[model samples]
Target: MIKAKITVTLKKGVLDPQGKAIEGSLSALGFEGVNSVRQGKVFDIELTMDDKATAEKSLTAMCEQLLANTVIEDYRVEIFS
Candidate 1:
């Protein structure tokens, strides 16, 4: 079996309203050093296939197809057994 960890985040130039909200909250809570915050999504997927290559390919396809908005988001896939 293989496990894939997919991390999805907004592209660097994209505006992250959620992240900005969190940063504002942190500052309000007296986190003086809080300069910026970026929010992202993580998905842990377990695959029956044991081959790492195949699992990676499948995970990438999943991200490209539905897990991520390719136009404004970037994704990284990590596979482990």
Candidate 2:
């Protein structure tokens, strides 16, 4: 079995309204050190694989297909033991 942790986030030029809201709330709570915020989506996928290469390939395909929007989002994946 293999585990994948996928993170999907808006591209740098894209605006993140949810992240901005969180930043506002943090500031209101006196978190003056908070400068900027960006929200991201996370996905955990588990699958049976014969080897590491297969696991990585499957994880990449999963991210490309459903975990991220290729037009305006960036995605990263981490494999866990």
Best by TM-score: 1
lDDT of 1 by residue, 8-58 (tens): 999999999999999999998988988789999999999998888888888
Write the residue-wise lDDT of candidate 2 on 1-81 in tens digits.
Answer: 888888998999898999999999999988988889999999888878758788888888987887789899999988887
**lDDT of the candidates, in the order given:** 0.93, 0.87
Task: Quote the lDDT for 75 in model 2.
Answer: 91
lDDT score at residue 35, model 2, on the 0-100 scale: 84
Clashes of each: 0, 0
Q: Which stretches of candidate 1 lie over 4 Å from their true place?
A: none
Error of 2 at 62 (Å): 1.3
Cα RMSD for predicted model 1: 0.6
Give residue 72's error in model 1 in angstroms: 0.4
Q: Tell me which residue pairs clash in candidate 1.
A: none
Best-performing candidate as measured by lDDT: 1
